[model samples]
Target chain A: MNARGDTTRKRLIDATTALVREVGYANVRTRSIAVAAGVAEGTLYRHFADKRSLFYAAVLDRNAPIVAATATLPSLAGRGTVLENLLEVIRKLAQLQEDLLPLEQAMIADPTLAPLRGERVQMPLEGPPHDIARYLAAEQSLGRVRAECDPTLAAISLLAMLFGLAVHPLLGNDLAKSELLGASVSYFVDGVGASATQPKLLA
Target chain B: MNARGDTTRKRLIDATTALVREVGYANVRTRSIAVAAGVAEGTLYRHFADKRSLFYAAVLDRNAPIVAATATLPSLAGRGTVLENLLEVIRKLAQLQEDLLPLEQAMIADPTLAPLRGERVQMPLEGPPHDIARYLAAEQSLGRVRAECDPTLAAISLLAMLFGLAVHPLLGNDLAKSELLGASVSYFVDGVGASATQPKLLA
Candidate 1:
């Protein structure tokens, strides 16, 4: 498309993203989206076929950064402190889950939209988990993570913890900023298991 | 309600549950529900005002067992080996997340169902996380857990790992049963931090 057409399409998507975050995907309508974009309703259809299609563009297309960032995880394995590198990935992931939570909620409320979501799923084959697993495998090869550790399980656990933490606020537990920032990373890396530096207690 | 009335109600709910599982909340109409229940369409209205109410009965009411079972987590704190007891709780919690996944999907797809779900939320104040936290606190008091560990974080991590694992199949990763049972428990309890049992490397 021409630059002018690209500008209009970008405006509509931006407006739709805002509305979706504010009112959720189910409540998003073409007229309001067009109004929010400062364009005619006809303009929305010109850019996209329907409201669902527009919503997909608004959300899924924006996930390009996350998908790209996740693809780079494996390359960072031995570059920094394992904990630091892992935390950077975890933070991005938590934000991605948070960003997608609304879309996910909308999909759950109406399962018919799931196919559209499926079509937009980033990394449909393996996803961020696989990247983390591969990254951990690389780290393990470097003798950073435990030799016996299951990279897949560890990767899943890290993502799970971060995802859970991301959703905690929705469930009403206000995690201290520190909890979200360092706690899971510390726990995942160092674990809650006592170390020789700590006191040992009853078995 | 009378015994016959109760039986009919149960039958309707059972049918509705099956249909919701089969087609999801958005596609489940009152007619199909009635047909599945072996009752006339009018009988469905006698039992539920609309499809959403029926969906609640079919899904949320069935969640009573999971809610009640989760409430019992704190009681299991000191009963057996901490790891074993925690595993049983994690298993139950994982199954609950898995059972709720479809319902959550349906709710997200149609955000209008959210309020109905909110009204039906099993633990309105807090949720399984609180129970898990309480359970961890009880275990910590028994000196089974380290003094410095955070119970809430620990609880969240355990639930998170299970939840992430539970959603794995949805993402197309079929984690081995051994990974699900042993990995999180081992990580949470013993940690991956180097110990007298394992070699230490990084600073």
Candidate 2:
């Protein structure tokens, strides 16, 4: 990417994000994006051949915090108490999600965008869940998590806890964010048993 | 308060659900819904009183399975092994979420649908997560799950796990549905720790 190309790409992403915010997800189109970016349709074509490519780049660039967060995850995953490390990653993702609420809705709304599985989607700071899953698996072999525990499920569940809150923030249903998260972490660290491993976080 | 009223309400709900599924979430309208249900606009209002009411009725009715599962959750949240019991409730919700796919997408795409937060969104099951949450709290009091656990977060996490899978199905993500679900459940049961609590499934 040359300087000119880089500038054009950035402009294109900025335009798409703006359009998505101004109107709505389904209303966006290639021509509209190009026009918004103040470039000819052919110019957008030069940078990215189609609307889907443009959309993907726009989404990826718009959510840079996800990328940045994923980048530092491996080190975090390896350090700290395993539970602390996991919660930290979840919190980081939640914060990124809060910052990009519009894109999150757009991603969920567009069925075409659903193919971003672990291997295909490259957010900046992702890829460590796989390594963490493997590490957790090694521990299971040696009896860290329940010997019968599944690491992939653990990774997905952890991610789900964060995403769920991000989706629900003040949207309704009266669960205070901090209080809810405190409970979540406490529950996850130790089971919901009265007689458990750790002391009561809320108490 | 007779058969006529019952039929009218049913027609309105059916019409809304059909419209939501057919034209996508954004294009649905009161007039189109009235036309679909073969009722006059005035007649539609006589039953639903408003568009929001119609929408809520449709969402609630379409999600009968989840509602039913939720209502039944109290039975499972107590006295059993922590992870196993938790997984069973989550699995029940996952099955219920299959019916909620389109409505869930609509909520994401349109802010108008944001009223869902204030609405008492429940599984068709009488008291699924709420009951389960209460039960888990009791179990926490009784020394079943981790004493510090927030059953509320656990409950929400359970729903979101299925939702994440629903958004990206096994077919689309190149994963066998069963295999992915098994892995998902395992990870969820285990915290981000090296090992995790195992789930027990009873009813």
Candidate 3:
């Protein structure tokens, strides 16, 4: 596509995202999306396959930063302190969820989007969990993490913790903002079990 | 008030729950709910205030077991090992989320349910997080938990982990069922950081 086509495509995706966030996925009309993009309805079809494809593109557009950040995680495995590395990952995951969840919840709530759920937008290897698992495995090789711990499970646990934190406020509960991220990381690193005799390896 | 009235109310709530699960909440009609319950439409209003009230009652009815189990958490603090007590709580929470999440997603998707979100159906003290926090605090006082750990924060973390696990499959990801729960609890108790010389305190 030429520069003009690229700009038009970008506009369509941005409009779709805004409209979905504003009126929800179920109510957004393709015609309104074209109007929001300052294009004719026919022009939208020239750039994308359908409204669903446009919405998927919009989701991908919004998720670009997190996907980019996840790609860099494997390289950070042995570079920084494991605690610092995981903390950065947690913060990014939290932010990604914050941006994507409303869109995701809207999709899940719509039954038409059900067929698309089985389709893998991002490969398993490209996911944050996989990248984090790779990072943890590297740390384990360096003896920064426990040798016996399953990196994949740990990665999933960390992902779930961040996901849980994001969803908590949605359920009408308040979390203590001051200590949540740091404290959660600390607890994950040192554990809550009484281990006075154990040397704090991460510390 | 009478046995017949009680039976009718139970049937109405059961029908509402089943209908909400069968049809998405947006698609379910109060009339259909009454029909499913084998009663007249007027009968539903006699037992409950309105359709919203019937839905709320359905949610509460499904949530009763988890609520009942949460009430007993504090008493188990010092009796069994902390690990065993927590595993049971985690299991119950996972089950509660599995049952409640679909109805929750349905409610969140519909705009009509927005007003009810702010209402406190269950008191904060009666929530699983608060109960788990109390259990951890009791264990901390008994020297089973690390003295410096924050019970409330840790409680939230555990709850979040279970919540995260429950929501994972909804997004089309598969979890390793064999090791997930036990490993997560163990990781929470022992910390994933390498403590080569640390005694296995929880073990």
Judging by lDDT against the true structure, name the best candidate: 3
Ranking by TM-score: 3, 1, 2
Q: On residues A86-128, what C-alpha lDDT tens digit does candidate 2 reach at each position? A: 5666666666565355555556655555554564654422454
Candidate 1 lDDT (Cα, 0 to 1): 0.64
For A1-203, candidate 3 gives per-residue lDDT tens digits of 99999999999988887776666676678999999999999999999989988877776777777667777877885676777777776776665555565565565555555545468664211478778888878767666777768888887777767666655434423232336766777777665332446343443
| DockQ, candidate 3, vs. native dimer | 0.42
- Candidate 3, superposed: residue stretches over 4 Å from native: A1-5, A19-24, A27-51, A108-111, A116-118, A123-126, A169-178, A191-203, B1-5, B40-51, B108-112, B115-118, B123-126, B170-178, B192-203
Query: What DockQ does each listed candidate score?
Result: 0.34, 0.26, 0.42
TM-score of chain A, all candidates: 0.78, 0.68, 0.79
The TM-score of candidate 1 is 0.76
CA RMSD for every model? 6.0, 6.6, 4.3
Clash totals in order: 17, 42, 0
- Model 2: residue B58 alpha-carbon error in angstroms: 1.7
lDDT of 1 by residue, B1-203 (tens): 78987888888888876765566675677898888889999988888898878766756656666667678878886676667777776666555555555564554445556664336354311467788788778876766665566878776666656654544324413333456446766766664222444432211
lDDT of 2 at B13: 84
Tell me the TM-score of chain B in each candidate. Answer: 0.77, 0.70, 0.80
